[model samples]
Target chain A: MCTGSEANDLALRVAKQATGHRGVIVTENAYHGVTTEIAAISPSLGGVGSLAEWVRTVRPPSGDGTAMVADARTAIAELQAAGHGVAALIVDTAFASDGFIAPSAETRAALAAVQALVRAAGGLVIADEVQPGFGRLGARGAGSGAAEASLWGFPRHALEPDLVTIGKPMANGLPVAGLVARRDLMQAFGERVRYFNTFAGTPVSVAAARATWDVLHDERLPEHAADVGDELRGMLAELAGRHDRLRGVRGSGLYLGVDVVDPESGDPDTPAAVALVSGLRERRILISASGRDNAALKLRPPLPFSRADAERFITELDGALGDLG
Target chain B: MCTGSEANDLALRVAKQATGHRGVIVTENAYHGVTTEIAAISPSLGGVGSLAEWVRTVRPPSGDGTAMVADARTAIAELQAAGHGVAALIVDTAFASDGFIAPSAETRAALAAVQALVRAAGGLVIADEVQPGFGRLGARGAGSGAAEASLWGFPRHALEPDLVTIGKPMANGLPVAGLVARRDLMQAFGERVRYFNTFAGTPVSVAAARATWDVLHDERLPEHAADVGDELRGMLAELAGRHDRLRGVRGSGLYLGVDVVDPESGDPDTPAAVALVSGLRERRILISASGRDNAALKLRPPLPFSRADAERFITELDGALGDLG
Candidate 1:
């Protein structure tokens, strides 16, 4: 695949073809890719109103397995009523646009419940690991179990997803992405459909991906990210104690999100988040805001971002917050 | 765009958005891209039966403008009756999959006639130059006018296409493609929708495209291709006189095709073409078969293929044909 969008677009097609259904279920504020079909399922792009008729949006998992399961049931019913039975339920592991939901037992259980419900309805589960996979969510030991397999290197996750899409950091910069799925599902689709892209799987692109993989293992970049991410979170938590505007900090590994809230009503302060993002840019500490309301400061840095770099970010963020006040 | 598929996919979206129509018209056996929506309009993929309800296909111009125009009228009527209306008519400038249709005054006139009819129905014209654009076709003098603009470099084609997609050889090897459209159409789509690809327009990708452009002009590659292509076609014609299997040669610049036919019936000999391709491979000369029946020998070499290379190709082809007999 040339981009993550292509991977996701292909994933949807594979799901529909393998399951013989056309309906799709995605999380609210979910962003899978930019292609026409992928974009139609990406509610984060233009909101739920922009979704195609065959698509249904469920709210992102919020620890309450009951609500998430109930929403999935409703969405599945809606799709079935429309004559487009559920084909797949796709979700970004990080839930980046849904305020970067943190990984936890409850979160995992909520996801599993939704996946189970979709599978029971004869729909596949697609974990979009484009953002949270590839060691961005920290490294887990071998056999850490299927729950831990959402991140790269922990392939033994207990949850058996029908398809998993990976991209963005695969080749570091070169265009490369792929879809990992059950052998039977792949064979079913591959036997009938002839999928070919001009530059996909080219020698140079594959070489880049191989080199990046080798570097990641040789340097133990995931471990490095884990350590630095811990320090960064600690610093942000300390800063939050000092500044009331800093509402909360959450996320895993290097992909952390800091919430900025209105001091008066404790509501999401989108303008304040925007101001802080601009301030960080002015101070030469690059960062951006994400989530549905753009209230969470998205801090996804390079795997090699060091403790010293974290210190600089913390220092600049502190100064920027003070200046804002 | 990262690849031609993405470019075409985006082009369709832009066309639909700008024109406020859902119908699409493409040539018979045309392949534009691989995305789901694109694959629907691409008749060469799964045949006309697999075409989406909104899509209609017309025969390629074969020197008969009247028949082509009538086909377009029927397709338009079908689309209109289906309530899809007409959004755009996309064509590969070289007609590569349609066995590399040679450019001619009749071909251009037929294309212009189809464009006029589609325009009258408020549909835009999209030129997919992924194969023949970017100087792959012979070069023309600066300001050579509309007749010369069918090839790359000259943009003054009498037909002002609403969008033109270019890719494949743009960066020589790197995956880089772009959609060049009229400003108003682009603006209309851009204002309502946001489009971004991860690796597209990166510094490295852009540099590669820029360097390729500089070399195309500085090395006069288009002119070189023209000279070599003419020599190669002449040699193939000379060889055809000796071998009854060799039928006809056609194309422009580096993009040329040779027809292989049965000696007695003068009908396409697909096996003979396949054997010839294999024979050339045995001789360490690389080429491929094209056309709906896979009977035409596709001889699209690098722009820098020289007269010496042409001689070598002719020698190898002559041997292959002899061995086949």
Candidate 2:
């Protein structure tokens, strides 16, 4: 696999083969990848048609996660009724497009319950960690060392998926991606399908990935992300009190989302979010907005981002937010 | 696109959108790519099931290509009858898997006719040049410089395709691939679908591709491939006259296929092909077998392969063939 899409595509294929079914479940607005099969599951890549008949989507995790569980139950029932039995439930553990939602206690329970429900429906669980993989979603608070942090999002959420898809930060800009699957499931796929990709697992790619892995652990960048992210979030929260449009801040590690809203109405302010993004761009700070209404600022800086860099960004963001008014 | 599979996958989607049809035509044993959609059209990646109902395969181009056209006609009729109207006809111009078939006069006519027929049926023609692209199929004979060479395979046969897919050599070993489509078709696709992929056309990847392109032209590697390939093919032909097991040689420029046959019965000798491949590997001259029966030695050396390297390979191949005897 040379891209996250290819890895997710293969993961779906493996899940389908192992489960002997065709139905797929995804979080609403979840973005898995760009491949045909994976794209169909990614509701965020909207096109002329709805999702394929074999695919269903549940509401993204929020609050107590009860609504999401209800949506999942309905999706499962609909899929079963349609005769396309459940094959897999693929999720981006960070729920990035769902506004980089931080985990709540009930959300954790819902994730575990959803995993069990999918398994009971004869489907595998695929954790797509392309956005929150390779120590990006470090666990413990600011002062904790890298050794104590969870390197991937699924583990942080206590998820034991049958397959895991990783990419993006893999080779630190080089094209390298991979699918990690349970041995029995992979063997089942290998017995029937001859999976192949030209640029996958090449010597140079593997060497680059290994080099990146070495730097990720040796320099303790994950812990650095956590420490700086905690400080950055605290500053953003302080900024939120000053700027009424900055509704809230959420997420963990270096990945954070700031809800942009109308000051009076308190509704999602997509125009304000767009203006804020452009304002930040003018200030030489790169950021984008995502979510159902595209009104949440997505701030996922490089792993080695530091407190000084964070302060510089916050200053610029403060200026940009003032400019937005 | 970061891989050939991605490019082909995008091409298929674009073609389907432009034509508003679902049926796809491909050569038997043709290899498009590994993506879920493209793989369904590639017969060579054998698995448990047949091609999807919307896909139809024609015989690979050979000797006049009449049989191939006949097969195409039947496939078109079948698809139309099945309510899957023609969307596109995708071909690897070199026909590498069908024993590296070189175009005959009739074959060239057949190609032109097929293109016209596909367009008449409201389908686009996609030339998959991952294997035969980047100046590997020079038009003029040996001793000619780079100017006269057709740097791509489709132009060698004077076949105008609506889309062209390229990979492998674009960025040397870096993961870079692309699909070149007519502006009209691209615009049509743009109006309907929202296609996106991460790691496509990044600055570093573009820089690598540009550097490779500069060297390819500055050093006239395609011209070198042509001149060296001409001599290599001539030498192989002479060697074929002496070796009883050597049945015939096909292909042009640097990409060639040598058929291995049982000396007495003149039938394809798959075992001998496998043994020759192993023998070459043992001698540190890596090569592989292709074609439906896996009895054709596929010789696709690096573009800069010189006369001296060809001579060394031939000497080793000669010894390997003798050892087989």
Candidate 3:
């Protein structure tokens, strides 16, 4: 069993301990976890605990996927030349909490590119899928959109990582997760010591996951998430364009980010983000900041959140934006 | 809530972050957890992991307790004077995973004294109650002793700490824990950033704790454990002087450890310890090596063990020890 935080920690540890890799790689504005290891790999995102010695941050990819992929290659060499061996490449599947932003086609390919590089460098790749799994990305109320596209557009299918870490809604808060690796790594872990959590494989949490998956599949929440996500993005776009403080919209499926901005320069708007998030809470819609300093509003409603809820959220956001004005 | 490993990790994090201490002070033979923090803090404990930076070890007390405590004091001063902050004074209580070997009273007193000095120097102290809490020490039957003792120990003694993390059997195998801090610290954490875990506070786990606690208090297991522990120790003592390999006993309440050695050279008889544990397991009593390379045989039965069971265990142990001949 792994907390999203622990999953990341063990991921780094596995890389460092197993392959003799000293250089750990992460991405800008990426969140690993609240613990020391996870935060260490993340740069200024939450790396305040003086763990930079163990991390190398690659700039997050923007429009061009190839450049993003190239960025990973550069990071590996730089780290290796600096005498720190690259052990593994760590990537979060979607920038869900950071900005609800999914990687571009080029960025996804870059992820694949680096996977091969890291493996040749005697490193592994760990994909963090905590938020996207369990059908949160395909809610129907969001309007059928790109999220429901074929395997090519499917976010998780974008990369075939060596290891995958998942948690959160896996058991609907029942507290269970698995650090599933390829047969080799799993055997290595199993051979050294059998891993078991007292509460990890609990019958109760297992039951919860089974029940939750049934509900998700039976109701086709993933498909629904796509519908709601497309519609929500359309509505959010109008809000972002109309308001001077609201920046561009990022994210796909139901995982969305309402980028707050500095009214004057349109730079990262930390204060605006806080105001809007707090404002949403006052209006009785739970939402909070995503990355460092509460710079982006994270909107991760349950998979079952309906269109009415989305409309109501946008309506309140419109009013909240006006109140700030 | 937290696991034994997490509890230990958080303890050190508080110590270092709170005290500005970089180096950790540990006993020569100690097992903290399976995480990086614990591994850094406890290097001598035998596990798959290796040593980490900023860790300093000292030999355990030699019955007088003076040697070890003095070692700690001297080590802390040296580390601090050399620009290392002695953030917190951390130690497993008298009996640690080192086969429940209880330090002498003097050693215990010295530890508390050094911790007080460290606290005076602006550090914290964390008591890892994961192994012994909730009636494990005094428990005789299926969680009755340990569980009851833990509940009453905290609420009754007013052993208020700056922080306390409890997990592992909190839900009888449910992944849940409580990171209890003084209101101020928790408030500070909340103020800086909101913290939430999907599975850390599972309702089913909560229910299990409630059920476990209910059975504990209702069954009067603590008294039974105390009653049984006394009997078990006496039997072990009678056998101790009789056997050339048996040296001494460690721990309190129901948690007991039999010293296995030539009773003369004072060197650890690791192979013998392993044999006895394996033999016990083969005989259908599940146990493991407690600390430091199978040096001490461990026996932690469910809380609801009975006097008849203890008698049976004694018979089996005598047979196993005789087989060592």
Candidate 4:
């Protein structure tokens, strides 16, 4: 794998090969990757009606475990009826594109139900950790205080995914990614097919990944991020109390999302989100908006971002909001 | 693009977007890249019947312009009958996997005719130069001494491909590739889609590409390769005169392929080729075999392969052949 896209693409290939099916299920706003096959299943890239015929989309978990399960069941049935038996259900574990869904018991249960339904349909579960992996969601079983655990750190009892795609922060900047799956599944695919990509597993790229991993562990970056993120969340919550436009702050660790809304109607304010992002850029503190409506301020800084850096970011954000008002 | 696979993948996407068609054409044993969609069009990957429904394969040029043109026409007609309008025809200009076909006026005319037929059906022409680009085929219009020019150095009158994918040697080994297409075709695709790869065009990768280009020009590697390749070709032809198993040597520059055949039948001899490759490896001289039958000794040494190095390779190959006998 050379990128998150390649990892996801390989994962899909493996799932289809292992299950002998073509149907795929993904969240309505999910973004798995940019490859041709992955892009077909990534609805966030091209909105509704852009998906491949073998693909079906379900709403992201919204606390109703039964409804989410029903949605997965329906998607599986639809695919089956269309002659494409269910192959896999892939999702970004952090729900980054679906406005960064908060980690709660209900949300977790919904996800669990969906996973069960997909498995019952003989489909594999793929956790795409391109966004939330590499300690961005904190250490394993650190609990809700650290929010959702990305694939690499997810507790065993929480979810048992068949395949996990990891990328983005793996090699820091060099292109490198990988798909982790059960030995049997990999062996099955390997026996039937040969997979090769130029520049994949290059010595230089692997060296970079090893060094990055060493640095992360040596510096205890995950714990550091957890502590600084908690502080940042509290600061943002405090600011929300002062500003009516600041709806709420959600997400875990350093990957927080701040909702910007219209005070009058409580609707997402895309213009204000745009203004604040531009203002932050003007102040030389870069940030961007995410979510389907692009109204949630996405704050994902370097792993080395410290408490002082958090304070500076909060102060600048506060000033920008005030100026906008 | 971060790799040749990604470049070819992007080229397919752009072609489909620009043409609004689904059908693809490729050589019978062609290997475009490793991406799923590209692999489907690459018949050599999984053999016959593994091609996507929208993909069709044609015989590569075999020095008969009329026959090659007929093959292309038949493939296009079949795809059209299957309701998949022609989208594009992608080929490795070097015919690398097809055993490095010697460039001749008949072969060039055959390729041109195929291009004309594909374009007439509203399909784009994609030149995959991952294996032959970056001065590997020498400067444009250097004739048979230079062989078929790759996209990066193709003479203007040779062929006007609609899109070209370049990689492998672009940045030395830093995983940099690119898709160059007509402005309007690119503009149309960009309007309907957005393409982004995480590590594409990174500063370090671009710096490497720039430095590689500077060195190629400063040392005139293309010209150097052409000169040395001629000397190597003469030596290999002399070897063929001595050994009945050596059928012939073909290709231009350092990308030469020596045909290994059974002395009695004149048919491809894969075992002899394999034995020679292993013998070279044992001597710490690395090389591999190519062609559909894996009977052509692929000698794509570095562009810096000197005359003395060629003599050494030829001497070792002579000894290896003698040992095999």
Q: Which regions of candidate 2 fall more than 4 Å away from where they truly are?
A: A47-49, A141-149, B139-149
lDDT of 4 by residue, A192-248 (tens): 886888788878789999999998878878777777888888999999999989976
**lDDT at residue B31 of model 2 (Cα atoms):** 83
Off by over 4 Å in 3: A44-50, A66-74, A139-157, A189-197, A238-247, A262-269, A315-325, B44-49, B81-83, B116-123, B139-163, B180-198, B210-220, B235-249, B259-284, B315-325
Better of 1 and 4 by TM-score: 1
What is the C-alpha DockQ of each candidate? Answer: 0.74, 0.67, 0.33, 0.73
Docking quality category of candidate 1 according to DockQ thresholds: medium
Q: Provide the RMSD of all predictions against the true structure, rounded to 1 decimal.
A: 2.3, 2.4, 5.0, 2.9
lDDT of 4 at B291: 80
- lDDT computed for candidate 1: 0.84
How much is A123 displaced in model 1, in angstroms?
2.0
lDDT of 2 by residue, A116-141 (tens): 88899999999998989987875554
Cand. 4 Cα-lDDT: 0.84
User: In model 4, what lDDT does residue B297 have?
Assistant: 93
Total clashing pairs for each candidate: 4, 0, 39, 0
Tell me the whole-model lDDT of each prediction, alpha carbons only: 0.84, 0.85, 0.66, 0.84
- Please estimate how well model 2 matches the true structure, expressed as its whole-model Cα lDDT: 0.85
Candidate 1's chain A scores what TM-score?
0.94
- Order of quality (DockQ): 1, 4, 2, 3
For every candidate, what is the interface RMSD in angstroms? 1.0, 1.4, 3.4, 1.0
